[model samples]
Structures are given as C-alpha cells and as structure tokens.
Target: MDEELKKMLVKILENQEEFKAEIRKHTEAITSLDEKIMQRTEALFDGYKINSEKIDELTDKIDDLRFDVNNLGIKTLKSENKILELDRRLAK
Candidate 1:
C-alpha cells in the first residue's frame, strides 16, 4: 500500500511540471501577440493624424476661396453701377 501511494504521488508531480511548461509557452505567445497589436495600433493612429491634418488644410483653403469670391461679387456690382451711370450721361 505504501508503494502504491508513492507511485501516485510521483505521477502527480510529473503532471504538475508539464502543466507549468505549457503555461509558460502560452504566456510567451500572448506576449508576442500583444506586441504586434501595439505596433499596428500605433501605425494606424499615425495615419489617422496625417489624414486629419490634410483635411484641415483643405478646409482652410476652401474658406479662403469663398472669401475671395464674395469680394469679387461686390466689386463686379460696383463696376456695373458705374457703367450704368456713364450710359445715362451719354443719353443726356
């Protein structure tokens, strides 16, 4: 009976050692995956920042163009008024 107990205890210890090895392997794999995910996430964030900057630049350019068009419209109206006045003088 004592020999049987000793055999069972040895088997349990061997199983425990194998379980520990497996856990170590899984931990290493998890660490590698985490590093890869972090690298990709950082790259994606950088791309988003660059694209946002480009969008802001385009918005500013569009605003400047709108301002120029409004000023041109006003100048065109004044020129037309002057032309009309000259035409009236000529008629007189």
Candidate 2:
C-alpha cells in the first residue's frame, strides 16, 4: 500500500477506537442513572406508606370523637328530662 493510504487507514482505526471508548462510557453513565432513579422511586413509595398509616390513625381518632359526641348527646337529653319533671312538680 502507498504511504498515504496507510496513514488514512491508521486514522480510521484510531477514530473507531475513540468512538468505542465513548460508547462504553455513555453506557456506564446510563446504568448509573437507572440505579439512581430506582432508588428515588423506592424512597417515594416508602413516604407514601408512612402517610397512609398516618391517615389511618387520624381516621380512628375521628371515629372515637364521634362516639364521644353521641354519648354526650344522650346524657344531655337525660338531664333536660329531669329538669322538666321538677318544673312540672313545682307547678302542681
């Protein structure tokens, strides 16, 4: 082969090596990014689990409050009836 052709072939081989190295670097970077994304997704799911538990706790507390309010209403009605009975006796 001529000197010029040999030099051209050497340059082409160098370019191919450089391109292959760049592709390998990019592949490693992509793999790292995927791992990071998976970690972030897991963290988000954990946060959601915690929030769901808190919501369930609050719901139970609200139910307890409702039960207490119903008991209070029954007690108030009994007291009012007693007062009415006393007023009727005094009027007689």
Candidate 3:
C-alpha cells in the first residue's frame, strides 16, 4: 500500500511539472502574438499616412489644371474678339 501511494504521488508531481511547462509555452506565445500585433498596427498607420499624402498631392495637381484651363478660356475669348474687330476694319 505504501509503494502504491508513493507511485501515485510521483505521478501527480510529474503532471504538475507538465502543466507548468505548458503554461509557460502559452505565455510565450501570447507575448509573441502581442508584439506582432503592435508591429502590424504601426505598419497600417504608416500606409494610411502615405496614402493621405498622395491624395493631397493629387488634389493640388487637379487645382493647378483647373487654373490653367480657366486661363486658356480667357485667352481664347480675347483672340476671338480681336478677329471680329479685324473683320469689321476690312469691311470699311
């Protein structure tokens, strides 16, 4: 009966050690996962910042194009008026 009790006690201690080891492994895994999550979050924010800058640049370019088009329209109107005046002079 004594030997049987000793064997049971030893088995319980071995199981306790295995449980501790498993808990350590799980803790390490959680820590690693947390680090990875932080890295990915930082990367996502960086991408967003880059995209926002690009959008602002594109908007500025569009504004420049609009200004050029407006200037061209005004020049065209002036040229038409000059041509009409020349036609009137020729008629006289």
Off by over 4 Å in 3: 1-13
TM-score for each predicted model, relative to the true structure: 0.88, 0.78, 0.74
Which has the higher lDDT value, candidate number 2 or candidate number 3? 3
So what's the TM-score on candidate 1? 0.88
* Candidate 3 residue pairs in backbone clash: none
Model 1 RMSD to the real structure?
1.4
State each model's C-alpha RMSD to the native: 1.4, 2.1, 2.3
Clashing pairs in 2: none
lDDT for 43 in candidate 2 is 100
- Model 2, range 7-90, lDDT digits (tens) per residue? 999999999999999999999999999999999999999999999999999999999999999999999999999999999999
User: Model 1 off-target regions past 4 Å?
Assistant: none
Kindly list the per-residue Cα lDDT of model 1 for residues 1-92, writing each as its tens digit.
Answer: 99999999999999999999999999999999999999999999999999999999999999999999999999999999999999999999
Q: Cα lDDT for residue 36, model 2?
A: 100
- Worst lDDT run of 10 residues, candidate 1, spans 5-14
Candidate 2 residue 28 C-alpha distance from true site, Å: 1.4
- Predicted model with the maximum TM-score: 1
